[model samples]
Target: MTVALPSILLVLLFALNLPVAFAIAISALSFFFLADGLPLDIFFQKMVAATESYPLLAVPFFVLAGSLMNAAGITRRLLHLADALVGHLTGALAQACTVLATLLGGLTASSSADAAMLSKLFGPEMLRRGYSAAFAAAITSSAAIITALIPPGIGLIIYGYLADVSVGRLFLAGVVPGLLLAGSLFLTTWWIARRRGYRPTRPHFAGWGEVGRAAKEAVWALLIPVFIILGLRYGIFTTTEAGAITVLITLLIGALVYRELSWAKLPGVLRETVLDTSSVMLLICAASAFGFYLAWERLPPAMASWMVGLTRDPQMLLLLINVLLIVLGTAVEGTAALIILTPIFVPVILQFGIDPVQFGIVLVTNLTIAGITPPVGQMMFISCAVLRVPMEVYTVEILPFLAAMTAVLLLITFLPGLSLWLPDLVMGP
Candidate 1:
């Protein structure tokens, strides 16, 4: 009952509406206190140790980079590029929002940040142009999940750190799956646009010349991902170094190249990054203590053994785990779910000889989707509040996009090649 009691209490704390970091911290303390011989001091040690990680440094810097990039007008350039590529299609604005989300995958590496930005940027415009609030919110929020699947995804970095897997491999592995998600959404948007009689923004496609010009203007924005992947693969920088370097580059671009991010804005950006980084670091510290508890109890190995006993079939086991992740993700925030569960699941999957890189894609994708699930999905709340769409209405509207995303998720699940191919090619497996 020692371990089980704390696990139960953690759920109860969550149900009581406590903050996630507090919930995890309280539960770990309870375990340490009630255990027969475990000292309370080690809990504090684990908490501090989690923060000492070099890789964890990537979190704060990436948050700062994303915020400054947005302020620098990088997002605006990419949005224009998104428009050039798809603005002539049926449901043109909706299609462009999905495309922008893909581009944002590199820039923000954050689903919540992307969701909030997309909602504020496109929510009003889509509504003003005759799109239903439900449709606007659904499309924008669903597309935001794609951002977390792409390279430089903050979630992937966290997963890689927690699981002891290579972050660079995870980053490269995400490219194909992220694009596949965009393609699925594009098809879904086309069907919805045609059915609703939503018209295009432009009468005809932007010619190659227009697309070329848009790409030219957005070239600086586009190079960020290429730089990150190449730097990591080539051993030019560690993940932490890559994040710091990117932040410096983005600040210079914002201040000098675009001249959009003014000197007066530096303090505000730092303040925002501190707030974002604090929440993430706090969660990491708390979750790490609880993680120590799991290790002490040997829970992950026991769980892995139990599953392996149930079905030696790797495919069946993965399907079951994905369902659990979806259900768990609906309650916990994506990063929290990832931090708490990665230690448990990674060991389980590795038993089947599964590549952690492929599973990382599936795991992060499921959790991001949960970020959009009702009735308390973080992204869903961000989008609905901004667009003024009710949860019940959004629950209905997001169904089709959710299905499309699930299809893409399953493809990544069953076809390991989809996730592994790029990483193996680029990084030599």
Candidate 2:
């Protein structure tokens, strides 16, 4: 009952509209305050101690790196690359949005950031192309989920940090799953375009000259993942050091090569980075205290046993967990839920002999889809607000894309090799 107190308080606090970090902090501190043997100071200590992790430094560096790259006009170059690659396809502008999200995934690794940027960039263009406001909003928002699966994604970093998995391996493992998502969305868009009689943005495919020109301009942004992965695989840098290096690389490209990000832009980027980093750091700290309470109650292994008892089949267990996460996602924000759930579920998966690396991909991808889902999806609201689309219309238009997303989700869930092969091959098992 005492252990359950925090869980109950957590749900109640969320229901009462408390902010996520504070809710978690209060719930966790209450457990320490109420329990006879537990020291209340330990709760405070855990919050401070969580920030001391060496791996956690990746969060801010990557955040700053992403901000600097954006200010440097990488998004425009990526948009051009997307256009050259897919602008001849049916529903080409919409298709470019999908491809751009994939390319931006490599650059930003942020679903929300991509969704907002794409919506503003493509929303007006799609409107001019005679596309429905809702369809435009749906594609932009749903495609952004791919960012969470790509290397250097903030979600991947947090999951890897909390799950005690290699961020490097996680980075490699994510590629195939991310591609699966992009391919599925591509096929789904093509099918929908054919039915709607939508035409490609470009009348014909880009010639080699056009392709080469665009890729050349965007080569620096494209090299980011390659640099990070190779650096990690060859022992060139630790994950934290990789982030620091990434910041340096982007700074040079932004300031010197692109010449888009200027000195005056530095303060704005720093401010945004500080705000973004603070929110993620605060969540991690609060989750640390709450996590300590869970450990004291011995909940993870207990829940792991209970869940395994419900079914010994690992595949079936994954399906069940996927359902639970999807339902939970509509209510809580993905990042907060991810922090809260990773500790509880990591033990459960290990008991089934499932790879933590694979689970990290699944967990982050699943929660990322939440940001596009209804009832409380942040991306949904952002896209809708920017495009001025109605929620009801956006909800309906998002279904087909959601189906495509779910298809890829199930594929990666069942096919461990899909998520595991690259990491195992490149970084070794």
Q: Which numbered prediction scores highest in lDDT against the true structure? A: 1
Residue-level lDDT of model 1, residues 1-429, one tens digit each, is 666999999989888878889999999999998988888899999999998999989999899999998889899999999999999999999999999999889878778889999999998989888999999999889999988878789999999998899999999889999999999999999999899998999999999999999999889989999999999989999999999999999988898898999988888888988988898899999999999889989999999999999998889988999999888877777777888899999989999988898999999999989889986588999999999999999999999999999999999999999999998998896
Clashes of each: 0, 0
CA shift at 202, candidate 2, in angstroms? 1.5
Q: For candidate 2, give the lDDT of residue 85.
A: 91
Off by over 4 Å in 2: none
Kindly list the per-residue Cα lDDT of model 2 for residues 214-243, writing each as its tens digit: 999999999998999999999999989998
> Model 1 TM-score?
0.98
Q: Judged by lDDT against the true structure, how good is candidate 1? A: 0.91
